[model samples]
Target: MQYRHLTAYALLSLSIGLSACSTAPLNLPAPHATETQSLLHLEDQFHLNNLATHFPDPLAITPEMKAFVKQHVPESLPEVGRLRYLTEALRNPRTFGISYHSGLTLTAAETFEQKHGNCISLTVLFIALAKEAKLNAWVNEVVENQDQELLADNRIAVYKHINAVVQLPNKQVVVDFSDLGDAYLRPQQRIPETRAAAQYYSNRGVDMLGENQLGLAYQYFKRALQLDTGTSYIWGNLGTLLNRMELYTEAEIAFREAYSLDNNDHTALGNLERLYLNSGKKSEAKQIRQVIVRRQLNNPYWHYGIAKQAFEEGKTEDALRSALRAIRLDNSEYRFYYFAAQIYRELGDRDNYHKFGIKAAMMRKAAQDAE
Candidate 1:
């Protein structure tokens, strides 16, 4: 395997929507006076500007729908006097063709009322309800190729499931009606203090980056930070992007922010150290090295950090040793073998270099095999 060029330019051309909203359950602020006014304006403009689009044709309430309302709609309101209801009553089931691109068509609210919708419909319902309740929400689309066992057949399918976050008066809640099982009013679960939304964007950005779409990845990382500034991973990733762009000052600031958010983050610390060293800020680099030494006494990623720093500084032997230790602890990481091979090449150790090169190739092949 050759030294993979992780260029920032690759992420530049991918186009993604910036204004997409979240539908996951989370505490969100109600639309303020200004936001409400803006939303109303947009809604009016949507009707006036898009005259060709048709409104939902209201159908007569069927006996099943009426029964569903009676059984599912809560008789009493909550203490806050909020009357929570699905968008529309249940409808007759229709067999959708596999060609139906469900997600591209439905809104979150529509999915909620329909009671039995595809992934896209459910997502649409989640977003619609959040907006109707005047809460802030957004949408995240995850893309991957995996196999699913359906009943008796094992088939390869691409699934797009939509889950939402609702910002209640106090806390954020995740609403997933995809597995509601015949029940219409089941409550969703609350995500622990984890940065799910941030991680979602970060992971997307990483994928785009891998595909050589740097500009799009940068936008994703920026959006991730906007959603959860406390996420150290996004901050560190942003710093790495800045570094790739050779914007040293901006990269330093991002690394500092990441370190401030989580001092123990090895990625941030290592990147910061590398930045200081490259810029000839020896004193700062030394200080960072001291911090790394102190933390490495107990941390898992310490050797990985040390290996990366050594490789960057042209310390081939040290880099090779530290990278080998890291690989020993976690052989699944391709970075370990990749960097170790580079070090072996630098030291003119052709045999060892080819060995590590083969290891890196095997690791990548294994990942693709598992997928």
Candidate 2:
């Protein structure tokens, strides 16, 4: 799953654990459980900090942007004008364009000021702007293609998917930041405002976790879970957070909860496998490895995950090889192209990077045309 930058709200990625396949996993039952002592303290002090701090209001609209929306969307608007003003214009560099930056979760004001953000950031901006225009719009976390990658902190972030849904007087509009030609955000489920806010915190938590800010990340993840306990991915991510803390027991419980919520969620299962192996349960680890292998066959995302891992390890050739394999398996996934381009760029192959970049741009156009 991958979110496309430059697209308003492209549905993005998710990754289950992959350590289950390690021929020899690391030692487990972590010594001192990392920071478990501080964790208990956080359990108490964390509650003292209100959820509002973590899930702060992301819809802070600026007066200038509000006025811009007002000027563009009149009470009586032409169909073409409505479409242009609401979608194209906001992203057109020559106009009131917003830049697309991946791996971020920005509030509306942040997006506006920076003019850049990931899919969720763009979606939140869209929702805020649409509301300012007196339009009915909301955020939706639709079923999506998940893309997983290793972060700077050696943690993994399965980029979640989000989009903005606007109900016009006579038509409904879906604004997505994606390049693939998928018509639906898979499940197309409507997410309430509160749940969307919770996601903001969860994504930020992922970022913080990658930065090794365990306490801060824990607070964000906890708030996210409290706001929307049903999101299996959040539970899975929470498990990852706990694992990094070396809190194996707590991590296991979180992963199990995630697995029970979404049996097919390989990420949770993967984390569980890691936990078992880390704790010296080789037999259990082997069992999980078998399951992961069975579930990965014919799954293009598996190849994509390998590509990401290789890239992280500075294996450009391997990354490109795996990326090409992923494309061969599923050319419809635009994200593979993005990775391919990045790989080429890393190798100083400017021509190849441009070639793949253009291909990705063309696919994005294809998606927009289909839309």
Clashes of 1: 39
Best by TM-score: 2
Error of 1 at 206 (Å): 1.1
Candidate 2 lDDT, tens digit per residue, 56-79? 677778997787677667647764
Provide the TM-score for each candidate, comma-separated.
0.35, 0.69
Model 1 Cα shift for residue 173 (angstroms): 16
Model 1 misses residue 276 by how many Å? Answer: 1.0
CA lDDT of each candidate? 0.48, 0.68
| Candidate 1 structure, TM-score to reference | 0.35
In terms of lDDT, the poorest run of 10 residues in model 2 is 6-15
What is candidate 1's lDDT per residue for 27-69, written digit by digit as tens?
1122233422222122231134443322231112344434444
